[model samples]
Target chain A: MVNSWLELGAQKKDTPVKHNYSIFRRNCLMGIVLAVLLMSGPQRSWGQSEKPSIDFFSGFEVGLYDFYFYQKYNVVFNLTPGFKWNMGNHWQLAGQARLTVINQLSNDVRRFYPSMLVLSKELKAGPVYLKGSVGAFSNSRYGFDLKAFLPVTPWLAFEAQAGLTGLLTMAGGWGMSPMGRFTGTVGGDIYLSRWNTQLRGVVGKYVYTDWGFQAEAMRHFNHATVGLYAKWNNIAGQLGQEGVSLTQSLAKGMDGGFKVTIMLPPYKRTHRTVNFRPASHYSLTYLVRGMAQYRDANQLYYTDPEENMRDGWFSRDLLKWGSHTMEPDFIYKGKEETE
Target chain B: MKRIKISYILLAAMVLLPSLSHAQQYNGTSGFLHIPSAEMSHEGDARMGVHYLNKALLPDTGFLFQGEKYNTYDFYLGITPFEWIELSFTSTRRKDTRAVTGEVGFWRKDRYASIKIRPLREGRYHPAVAIGFNDVGTTAFNKERTDVQLYFTNIYVAATKHFGFGGNELGVNLAYRHYFRNYNDKWSGLVGGLSFRPAFFPQGRAIVEYMGNEFLIGADALLWQHVLIQASLIDFKYLNLGLCLQLNMLGKKYVVAER
Candidate 1:
């Protein structure tokens, strides 16, 4: 009403055709503002239409590792009850509980504690994508992690990842260690969409202070994925206190294995505030390494629970949709096709 | 000419109907008794069940920590993610007759995985062939000593061919298994199996297989389209039983190639 009165006063001064057009434009702007306010309800501010949502995921966590001091292999199976809260604006808070049902883990570690409690955010700036998270994460660590990616083409990309974390064990009770370890990696990926294949390689420092490179070749199905991966760490072939040459490690210290991950049923879910379902994916990896090689500091740790090659959050189709669809040539082609 | 076309259609239906009558083996694979044939189920088929195992079934070719002379329960699950691959996970119990303590049960299950890859398909001129491995990621405990033993690890290559004798069908499976770690010659060398299904009783099958110098004769039947029942006599002494339930991942029937 106040804007209308001001427009009326301006009209009394200049009754021109240009004055009428300006008033018409001002009315349209006011209508948009009013519509936004009405759609957001009384609880939300402008441009914040997304509401906080909750997600419940159920699955089992399988921990298979070589080199148990007493046993040959360490197997830990836990029922994972995960919860996620989407705070909107590309931020989410997720955590899963680890209630050990069966285990042959180190010293028969029986744990019922939080597996992960992290807050992560993702942002896209032009062709660059950035993501960061902070809190207690998987692989028994608590700290901050950051990831950045730049796409060279639709099917090829490069990324850099870094993290700083410390030991976190909840076997008998709350046990913590000094947060002083730093690990980082630079990686590249080549995706072949025709065959639904991915080839990725990452090189840098591992959490065990081992500098190495890991490569993977994965095949993706609609709801399943299978892959083969190899690892080579500089600490593997080291004799005494002196590190061996890179050539020796590459030849004699190489280790590889196969991995299979399958997605459970109910691929689609109803949109609701609270949703609970079984785990979406189950992963089993068979790494070929002896106790000597395992103890040589070629171990690996993870911060993200959903990190994978093909059937992961950042799949080939999704990554391509974000990058390839925005190109000028494809944008014009899309418009033509739509028309 | 029209009558001849109808007769051909009837013959095709009779030939393709038996493919839907496949049942799960005692080891939870898609084949006969203890033998795994090269023919797989639908690509998305998933199966889960339990079996009643007799401790005396493979006495001479058994684990070092053999349990008492009794029956035990074993749980297993299998899935076919692709037409050429079959993956299975099992938690099989090894009886420990030496466990005089009361801290645990008489037997404890050790989880293991197995995979089979069918690379060659049966055509007009060739039989289907598959290669498989059991106990995939097991680490050899105490490699130099006898404290811990690698009990069950076998790698095998199998080929199967189907023959149609009038309205009845017969499948012959030939496989060579190579056992590793503890018992290298337990079920080693060549083995064969036979499966026969009459056209009038397509839901039932007669299976006979030999492994470890022992013959296992069994009868398998499918009930209600999804439940599989098996009863086998191992070496003509011990009785082994199995019951399983399976379904296609999409709640559909078999694929066109198999159908």
Candidate 2:
């Protein structure tokens, strides 16, 4: 079946029939151009157009258990790799992928990992440059996110966000089914020099088969950020269980952790510039934290271990970076050996 | 002969008192009343009441009232212009037995208002549904927020028989209530209850109610045609057993010919 499908695709590509290869190729080229315009337009206009940009961040935390079964403190870790491109003016397109790992100390649980992909659009709308992400996380279970920022001053600004996250049935274990969760938060950011600091408190609710309250606080510092979150889930009622009867089933708990991120430059030319640089951007970040989780046994247990680690380092010089250069000047000038 | 006439008049007034007080003009009007239970050690427990109808009151306007229990007394009033809709405002005050540990009295009071509606009007056995939103203001908390507001909806079906004390009428009701928003978040449970009311009596009428997992019973009586009295006893299931009283403004009158 796979071979047949591939043969059909290849035949379509070779055929010059109407609505075939030419149209597909045109659409693909258009998509690539649009993506390039959106990702590079802002960075070319912003300051530091010449110097390559890189961001680095990381953090750590301690977890504690306060329940009936194995009660102890543990550790966790996380890491992220990100890239930012100036689209033009004060606008930019940034992309990041986060990898998280969790380890339980007492129970000897080896690894629980999740990943997030973020595509953010940032623009200066008045005094503050608003930033927001329109992306998906965890295999696209979560929906979209909308965020806004208003600068009280150049150094400080107020920010707010509304997000809908999907809780997959597999992720919720036995207690909760797959459902969408709504979250809203309002907070402020204080930029101290190159180091941008943010503090935000959030309140929201999860509406699944069962509905419950959700709250969280996050502090982001430049490339590194830390977050503390708590959820009070009530799933038993939807399963036809009475509230009083389910009160002893399990207790809600909190999860908190620190995360770091490294920003890498683009692999291609910074823009449609005449000069072609032979170096690619790269980043590496690490994070560690602890979580207090509640199990169905009505016990609070602390599970903490090295949570996440990520590394992304690359060099373009060996790959003849400018061989496929697109700019007219770069094509005409040819590649030069940097001694 | 004059003395006899005066005695007869007095007797007539006494006989007409209860009907005159309980003769409500509207079908779906709600009011607030304090509940006093004789069976419980604590006598004064107050609650708010709301009702709505389509056949009574104005064509479409309804009325509501709220009241609190002070020791053994309850005060309430209501108005409804529409038969299908009603609104009620209520205030309740009671001593907090659990707050005896502090120097200040554990007396707490709450004020709230609610609106209700009934959809089916003409059936002998009709299902009545109502949804209400309430803002609870309590004296115990210094800063009041809308965090504790309550959303409640219920559906009930009732059947009436035309044979009470004098072949008048009697109604039996069964209802299920789902509390949501804030109240259900704290107290999660399904409430099913039953109510019974007599059509008429020599003077007025009476109502008996039962609810909760444990058998809880409550009763209310109308007197002097305008005044109502009620009480109840609650069991282990957090059901309230209480009594209540209402004063009627309109009473029935009968004509007699002199011999």
Candidate 3:
């Protein structure tokens, strides 16, 4: 099933500059470390020998923004044109540009900005897929964001991202400075029959330890995939209003949305589908290939005539793996030499 | 003798460790996007991608240290229609003024086309090889004038390799560039550098290079796989910051079968 989310928020607040910088640095370091560990994890070995594919497509997105979870409304219209290059070996690079037009009920001036641009690189490392990107709005640095998906099982995967926007808070304030705040989203996805569902617990400065749940059911036609979803959010922080009980937090932040995304095909080697595959690439490939070609270890393979003939087609010793064992008498007897 | 044996034992264990894991697999070469380094990874985006790189500082008022820094923004769009071949268009901002003083009123820009072709994939014994041209258009700030200050054409050959032990990977890049400039001296020398990404955080890298007779050091941080922030120091005195957003254009999909 195809599932995605488009979230936008902005606010401004004055905080201690040193504290903000420290928090940003710490989180940045933590994000990098986590990416490394995830990439280095044990991987499943699903692979296709084919090369990667490339394409360009465009779509439109419309969202109704509800202020105070009430009737106050602002509508946002976005024209998103995207270019994607799936570099067959689990590395995908995509760039997206957003031409956003916002119509606010509170203001007469229609705000339209063609300033949103994003470039992203995604690596499917082992069981975890990590994506990091830089975004620019109006020729200035907008912010940086990262999303990671870790599969616990075939049907369940854990998801998390740095959702550092605090407009989700109720002070009628917004901060558009990206990566300026330290917040994160922690959640999991359940792939049921015909449905992909997400239940997330988000914490940090913005959401203030809130809970969000989303359920999307998607259907595919010949070209496009359409999905409808309803999301409900609950914040652990109290609303400070008098007589507000526990149920108020749950009932107040209800949002229902639907999205129609069309995909045009040539999907043979694209691997952009919802299907999961075993990862073939890892960091150890380099080290193993390097050490295996060390002088003394390579001597055993070249000395034997049959071994040399079998590996002759390959130019580098690192590529001659089958018969380069440490044994001095190792021979290339094919399958019979297994022991 | 004891220390040598211990080192050998450690090296042996490292090579054999991956064999113990039955499930682990090697995906392919991994490295940064755009911001080229001496490290060779055969992997690139499959389609067309656009990136914008900005050089943070240029001296205002022409060489005399007016205590003012000029910002030069470069918009670069690259497309790898084929895996090994990349064609790119770069538009750079150049400052021009015939008046010869303070905050030149005229800003001229030019577009240049370049191509990078990787002839061979990097192996343990051999580096990945590429040949490319920079400032191919020879487009200049002022073509009408008798003097053009910002026009130089260069063709370069580069070799990049990755050396890794466990999770630690270091990329070494060696490049030779031949500069074509008629106004000032001919015969440019070798330009090369090294890049390193820590094992703990592969998303960020530190790079140092000597290009065009100037020493440069910088770092690139990739966030969310889309945004790249680069900060560099040039010639020890000038600091430059570049921010780029990478975007991809996906071709129309044709679904042939229904699962």
| Candidate 2 chain B minimal-lDDT segment of 10 residues | B34-43
TM-score of chain B of each: 0.79, 0.46, 0.64
**What is candidate 2's lDDT per residue for A1-339, written digit by digit as tens?**
101222234444655555444544554454355445445535422442223343222232223322211222244443434444434332333333333465343333223322333444444434443344433333323334445656575455566655544322122121111213455555554444322223333333322223344343332222223233344445422323555444443332322222333222232223333333322212221111112121221111101011111110101121111111111111212334210
User: Residue A253 deviation, candidate 3, in Å?
Assistant: 64
TM-score of chain A of each: 0.72, 0.37, 0.48
Tens-digit per-residue lDDT, B46-105, candidate 1? 778888776645333333443334456677778776679887777566555333443433
Global lDDT of each model? 0.63, 0.31, 0.40
lDDT of 3 by residue, A1-339 (tens): 000011222222445567656766765676566556545543442142124555455555464433321232356565655554555434444444555565443342223333334444445556566655444322222345566767676556676766332111111222233245444556654444222222333222223233455444433222222333444444321344567665674444434333333332333332332323211111100011111111111010011111122121111221212212222121222322311
lDDT of 3 at A269: 31
* DockQ per candidate: 0.06, 0.01, 0.01
Per-residue CA lDDT of candidate 1, range A1-339, in tens?
Answer: 101222234344656657545654554454355334333333222123235677787788777554432232466788988887767654668887777887775453556777788777555545766566677777676666767778887688888887766556565556554444578889988877665567889898866667878888766655666677777776664533345555665655577666777767665445466767676578877655644454434444444555544433332222453212321111112133110
Best by DockQ: 1
Candidate 3 off by > 4 Å: A1-339, B1-69, B96-106, B139-152, B182-187, B247-259
| Backbone clashes in model 1, listed as residue pairs | A58-A279
Clashes of 3: 51
Residue A82's C-alpha lDDT in candidate 3?
A: 53
Question: lDDT score, residue A184, model 2?
Answer: 57
Mark the regions of model 2 whose C-alpha exceeds 4 Å error after superposition.
Answer: A1-71, A74-102, A105-114, A136-143, A152-158, A164-182, A186-202, A205-339, B1-259
- TM-score versus the correct structure, for each prediction: 0.66, 0.26, 0.34
